[model samples]
Target: MAGTETHYTLPRPTFDEAPKLLIVVAPYYKDIADDLIAGAKAEIEAAGATWEIVEVPGALEVPTAIRIADRTADFDGYVALGCVIRGETTHYETVCNDSSRALSTLGLAGLCIGNGILTVENRDQAVVRAAVDQQNKGGGAAAAALHLIALGRKWTGGEKQVGFRPVGA
Candidate 1:
């Protein structure tokens, strides 16, 4: 008699088990913003967790939203989505730099805000990057959030095996 083989599957942690997620998006580039939102929503829902979308006037306003959102509740993580294309003026640089800096501060404070903002040379590139493709940055941002959230949980001892010892116990 031939024996049947069974494949073992690893259980995927459900999103409901995590804290919560907030997605903050900049509406300056509405088209690209739409792309980022679409991708982000897919990932969030696929994880089986709740997600809220907040809009900012422009890239300059993303960090503030993140800060306020982070403080309001215990979010599992956050995703900051924006697209800034370089123009003939230096205004592009300023917005990109300032927003990046502000978000970095929040992350350092353990906000777990995913920096999915794209600073592209042109609208075409930004659109391509934001699309749901290999270059889809929205997914990348969500992944970062997931990783950070898990890291935080581990550091805070979310795992049950943290204090486990050998059979000698």
Candidate 2:
């Protein structure tokens, strides 16, 4: 038999110092939402940051909460969690498109939003994706925030910290 190949896994990124995290959640799918929040909290804690959770009505409200939170300059970054399952009408498309756009605009302005708003076809898919697995999207979003912050530090001449406090606020 041929020898089996082995692969080495890398360690998760650790901050030089822990930063604060603001989490915005849309409780459309309670089960999925709870799971996502748990995964995100665990990752944030592991990275040595304090985390706070805020609840909104549903996916339609996530981006707005993120934008509002962005105005505060309170946390280093943010994570948005919600589930949008497609239906017969195009309402799903509209929500997904709009939410994604708003989040991107916030990110461009130096507010790192994880954008974990799940647009799945059904509840089962949402459940499977939100938990503490290797592919947990919530955990992935938390990691995204951490990575973006690191990249920001590189770009800002070693400033290493950025608060929201959007202009004209």
Candidate 3:
């Protein structure tokens, strides 16, 4: 089974200047959400970064909160956490696809984001993936954000101008 296979993880990254992050979570499943939050927080702290958290109503709102924070807050990166289990209707697919697309769009727009939202077929799957000692997808998401933040710092001051400049004498 996939669970029994070995996988490679990148070495934990560090930063010269402490980074500030925002964690946005949807607590539809409170227990699952709590577990994800714990794992993400642990990883962020271990990387010597500080984080703030906000809870949204559901998975669809997680990205919106991140975008709001990105626009008006000073966080260096964001971690999105939630759990969406398949239901009898098609709502599950909509939530999964839209939330993911929104986050991806923000990421492409140069906002450092780690997407930890879990879309699973059942509660059992969500439990396994959310466990800190198991899949630990939350930690994985935090790591992703950290890595992107590191890259952003590395390229900061080295960016080339791309468009028109103000008229000079």
Candidate with top lDDT is 3
Q: Please, what are the lDDT tens digits per residue for candidate 2 over residues 26-99?
A: 98888888888888888788878778899999787887887777776688889888889999999999989988
Which 10 successive residues of model 1 have the least lDDT summed? 1-10
Candidate 1 residue pairs in clash (backbone atoms < 3 Å) = 20-76
Ranking according to TM-score, highest score first: 3, 2, 1
TM-score of 2: 0.82
- Compared with the true structure, the alpha-carbon lDDT of candidate 2 equals 0.79
Which residue segments of model 3 deviate by more than 4 Å?
165-169
Residue-by-residue lDDT tens digits, candidate 3, 35-102: 99999999999999999999999999998999899889899999999999999999999999999999
After the best TM-score superposition of candidate 2, give how far the Cα of residue 5 lies from its true spot, in angstroms. Answer: 17
Q: Supply candidate 2's per-residue lDDT for 126.
A: 82
Q: Write the per-residue lDDT of candidate 1 for residues 16-96, one digit (tens) a residue.
A: 374578999997888888888888777767667668889989888989988887678667789899999998999999999
lDDT of all predictions:
0.79, 0.79, 0.93
TM-score of candidate 1 against the unseen true structure: 0.80
